[model samples]
Target: MMRNLLTLLFPVLCLAQGTNYNFKEAELKARELVFTQPDSALVIIKKTLANSAGAHDTIKGNTYHLYGLYYNMKGMTDSAIYYYKKSLPYIDNYPKIILRPYINISASYRNKGEYETSLKYLNDALTVTKKDNNKTGEAMLYGEMASNYNYMRQYEKSVDLLLKAIAILKTEKKTKQLYAIKQKLANTYLGMENFNFAIDLYKECLPGFKEIGAEKNYYLTYINIGEAYIRLNNLQEAKKALKIAVDGLKKFDDKELIGITYSKIGNIENLERNRESALKNYKKSLDLLLEVKSLWTLRIAGEYIDILNQMGRYSEAQAIINKTAPFQKNTKLNMVDRVVYEKAIAETYSKTNDSKAISAYKNTITLMDSISSAEKEDAVKEIQAKFQTDLQREKNVVLAAKNNALTKAMKAEKKLLYLYIIMSISFIVLILLYLRSYLFKNKLQQEQIKAVESEKALLQQQHLHELELNNAQKEIIEEKERELTSTTLQMANYQDSITQILEKCDLGEITKVSELKKELQHLIKQKDYWRQFETRFNSIHPEFNQKLGNKFSKLTKNDLEFCSLLKLNLSNKEIASLLQISHESAITKKYRIKKKMQITDDDEFEKILSEI
Candidate 1:
């Protein structure tokens, strides 16, 4: 009877095993495609889910988790969070699968700028890791928590959490995770403005990432190194690092990373004052970032606005500001980007002479001050953390010495007295060495503090100097504008006087009147006055006509002269007087010029001339 029962159940067991194997295979395939081909991954996930009816809870949970990962990679954090939550209940019985959903949900919330909610999820994951005694999972949770703190601008807490994670991962010999956490720690240091340390840590992680076949992470480290180099004003090295990053990142479908890489390239171009090149790179970055709804959009947009303002494209800059208004209001907007955006807006208003510029500048200053304070606090916290770590190391060394002494004492009574003497001398020597090391570290810490303070002072002086230079330039431009307006009005008055004289000569029968009229005609036909005006305009705005002509080749010499007067903020009547045409004719001329330029927008004609 037992043998007959076994024979009947055999087919059922084999079928069940086959279903489980299929689910596992599908999951692995989906995971492989999640980063490089999320759409393909999603198709696999859906098919797996379809076939997962009545499957074990683990299988259902893994499928749902893959769905979440797909959305996360695409930067659709809200949907990612929902799917991650869906997987949690089904995954609760399995520690390995359960922990990932919790952690991933936390990361999604972090991406959404909900740092507090992100932390709560991380804490929940931490509970699971603790319960399961999963050292690796626990370390990973700490790293995730560190990232949340990093985004919050609480760098000290970030560093502390990262160190804890590193400690655990090191003990467990998890090299991949250890380097990953180190990269994160490097990011924190970058935030702290310790570029050298950040660059060193990033370079250290590159080899480890490569060794582990983490191609994405290896490239990302290069990108980060480029950012550090940029901050240090090392453009050559920045370009080299970013080039590698861009070339490597192009092999993957991670648009967000690629977009970020492009943005860094834009930064390099901006630093070089290559406005056109910077704008091009920024546009490329914006296109990809917009598709992903990536948080980096705000930063790159701010940078784009700066370039536009520099190019005298205030209206275009304003358009970008308006478009990104919603992103500005987001609570999770990065503080550094917030400052950049505010500064760009201030520059736009300043260029346009808008009354709101003062308030905008003040806002930028306030944001900058806040960032400076945060940096100072981070520096202090870092020193304290290092001191604490050193103290802990000393305590551990002493404890080890005690254990060694005790072990030696228990070996034999005859040698115990001699061992105690030897151990006492060794303990004193160890204490002396620790004291010397502690003092050296303390001195180094003090020097670092001084260096930070000095750097802050220098930055403040540089900012003041920049403001003064900007003010001087503004004053010079205003003086030139006043001079140009005065010259143009004088020329207009001279022409009016000439016309009156000519009319008087026509009426009177004086013999010299004919010669006077002839002389006036000669003066009017000579173009010497117009040439003087052009020279003065060129003095005030060099390359204005040349640039306009280059951009709008169809514009005639007369059209350029009309545009130049418009650039001086002349009234329509003033413009008509200067051009020796009727007010109606002046308006018609402007319309014709716009037509020739193919500018449909009412403001675009003026905007184009102004930009040129």
Candidate 2:
């Protein structure tokens, strides 16, 4: 009887005392919950912290990391970094976990403009990651480091580093990471004045981004590539890419990114001599950017100021400049600001033809020229100090911890239990929901993310009223890239469409035909696709094709595919690749189309579409 009673008491005590249970499941669950149900995750972190007040290092680390993630979700980056560091020592034996902490800290510092320091941490994180063969961590750290370099205008370093990261991600088959790295690499090339490479990379990254539903990045890539094309005087390509960005805005909600998109589109339109459209997009960009207090975008507002000055709306432009000046000053002079703002101001002065402003412009040029060096030095000093300070402070924590109670542990445990139960229940629910919802939510989030692009679209009108002295127009490098991207995407799409048509012809199987058609259908389902094409065509005007269809009113899908060849107007050799046929096959198809339309060898059918 005594033994039976003892057994019952043991279980009761265990329940009250809490077993370790590996907690991996809990930790994973918590991470999944962090974004989907942040509030719930917060409660769980609180409960877990309470339940395991002085638990093992692993348990404690999990609890702290969860809290850190919760804070990150709230935009409390400082608190998130703090908690992440708190989790660091506990996971010291596990460098893999330590790697994550450094990555988080690096990101926080980056947003804080502590780039040099951010770089150091990423380097350290890189070392840890190699030991553990943590491919994801390595890829992320490389990206983070590259971005820091980008901010410093060390485009070469940024590109080299990001390329290495991209290679690793590709080797690991990490599609998301590869997509991110590719997009970032595109930016680096854009900055480096390699428009062709920038455009090509952005085009390469698009499919993966679409598959993952990373809409913000997609819009950003589109805008960046478009701007590059415009720089290269490829107005058609620039217009096409910008149009994609404009259309993308309708599906996204992040105002800031949208604002950037709009600003880009406006600038493209301005170059196209569609002043009215340009004005509309600039206004959209400015309004959204202002809402978020974006300094990078404030420079874009300066573009509008230049335009206004060109139109002789000096007073209005001056007023708008005055309004944005304080906001720009308040932006705290990060590396990006130092470079973009000074260059813009100098250009603005030059465009306004103010001889008196020449002195100011020269000074501005001096600042722009030296900003990168200064930014790098500042970044280094800040991080070097932070590392030393944090290391010293940790020593203090070790000394202070000696004063705490091991004797009153049971009572502490009991108190922890109540905290755990309450917090865990709330957190678990949230985590499950986050895990369940992440795929759906990320997909649905496309619209929310694209909102930033919409805001970017409207900045043109604002530009006319407030910024007639624009300098970004001379910011030609990035624009050239967008045009290149449009060209590449157009070709890639043709290749795929041709392959599809060829597959249907070769197999002639009911199932194969159905599958090929289905695949084509899916591609068109993406708003990016031109319906008549095999894949998503970036340069061709889908609506133009649609209008032609309306006029004809009876074109078959194959006929449309045949018309798609009109896009490139490639020779029979080129058309064969687009249609998945031999050159002879392509020529025969062309002849058949000619016969159907009652056309002769005298007239080129591709040229006819241009008239339509």
Candidate 3:
């Protein structure tokens, strides 16, 4: 998608060629004007040339190069080439200066559709850059050459050069250039309709752009991802990525990109049969496109006309067709777009029951048939060519494997012959040595058997000890759980007695109510009872209280008590009776415990406590 925002050709600023006459400041000033004020840029370059006249050819050469760069930015290819050629005579004195002129002139020629000449200049630049061992420069040359090949429709060659450039950029650690080169490679993959590879490359480079805060590139990467998803018929994911791109691009003045993003979203909606949303997004896209007067707006218009006709709004669709008629002839609509326009017009005509509707339908059919025939022919050729290539590659692989086998066989044969010679020489010595070796081997085997038996006995003893230790631990845990259960039952009984005494005191069953109140108060202050219960619970589930406190530092003493009761797996009714509270309060306390621990409904709170 960033292809729509073509890379702006700018001058590459470098230090002055020689120490004779430095004009870096003036060149910087001139370059700043090249894009916004080309006339002023020309003036600055002319002034620099005049002032530096009779100076070293290096100074004059750079001025002439700036002039060429200025004209190239202004789209004056002939004048740019003239100035670029004028600087060539000074290359011997300033070798690096030759690179800029060559590169700029190539780009200029490329803009003029003179790809052959452009490639020649690029090749010359490559030779110079290679001789200088400038990896970054060479990488740039490869990218430029790739772009020229891309224009020539030799996509495979373009992809090859782009890969070479990416390798060089990686070695140079030129991150920005690497991003651009990889993006171009991804776009080439897109042209080949290799959507998955394109998406992978886009995702690979996305983080680099995001890390550097390259907003334009970051959003454009999303747009490209969206386009890939659209091609793969993944409408939901396509809508997501395109919507993100639109939101990010809306913050900037990139209307064209924003419009394209909306158009893609509209296409998704249209495919999903969301007619209302489709119309809304299409109109938004058209409005933005109209502000920029982009040629691509006609394509959106054509699609919009179809949606309108589908909705039975024939007059509205006709109105749009009328408005688009003038632009249709001037704008070079692609075959697919022309097909859409023809179908829309034919559909509108058919709604009116016109005789011309038959002719229009026939024309649309003929165009479709011709396009289908060409596509089928191309597909057949591509398949046949691919099969041949695969066959040849397979043969080469098999032959190479055979050669490798033969080479290995020859080496093995040489080794075998050498071994035979050695064996003959040592035949008598080997017989004497073999008897001595056999006696030593017999002793070694007997020692190894004894060691093996010792190790086996040691492992059995260790396993028996581990089993004993496990049984002992299990018994200890079960004993502690029994102690805890007995203590809980006692506490529950004591609590029930206290409740009965309080109830009798309230009901005047105890005539000495003051004495009964004092006894009930003493029973209620059962600190020692709770302390005993906590000690036994900890012994059963060690670290339960300490871990709950450590994990939830804000948990109060009451919360710890609640967790301890849960650790012992006490029923809520038993806990309520033990605490002398209603069952409802116990449930409320449990809810509070869950909230404090941030436990979810799906999490087993008791299980978590037991693990801790």
Evaluate residue 197 in candidate 2 and report its C-alpha lDDT on the 0 to 100 scale. Answer: 88
Residue 543, candidate 2: Cα error in Å is: 85
Clashes of each: 0, 68, 0
Q: How do all the candidates rank in terms of lDDT, highest first?
A: 1, 3, 2
lDDT (C-alpha, whole model) for all candidates:
0.78, 0.64, 0.74
Q: Which candidate is the best by lDDT?
A: 1
TM-score of each: 0.56, 0.46, 0.43
Q: Write the per-residue lDDT of candidate 2 for residues 1-612, one digit (tens) a residue.
A: 000001011100112235654355555556546644667767667766667744667667656866776665454567878998898887788765566567667866775567778888888878887888877768777887888888667787898888888788788877666767777777788877899988998899888766654454566678888889987989888878877876774443446556777777787777767877877888888888777666455567777766666566666666666667666555345544544444444344444443324444444444544553554667545544543454454445444444444655778899899899999999999999998899788877897778867777677667675554355543442454344345545655756765666666677653665777776776665553234233433233436567657755556667766665555454677666545568898778777766666678636666666565
- Could you tell me how far off, in angstroms, the CA of residue 429 lies in candidate 3 after the best superposition? 99
> In model 2, how large is the Cα lDDT of residue 41?
62
Candidate 2 segments whose C-alpha is farther than 4 A from its true place: 1-93, 131-136, 166-176, 212-216, 233-255, 327-359, 368-612
Worst 10 residues of 1 by lDDT: 1-10
Model 3, 1-612: lDDT tens per residue?
121112222333444443454467777677556544557878888877766745656666767877776665443458779998888887644445577778778866775557889999989888878888878778878888887777655798999999899898888887766776777788778767899999999988888676544566678889989999999999899889998888876544456678888888988999999999998998888887777655566678878888988899988877776766665564234445566666677667656444445555554555556556645556545544544454454455545666678779989999999999999879978988998999999999999999999999999999999999999999989888878888888978887887788788788888795888688788877756777988777667767778889988878989898878877778889889988889999999999888877886725787787788
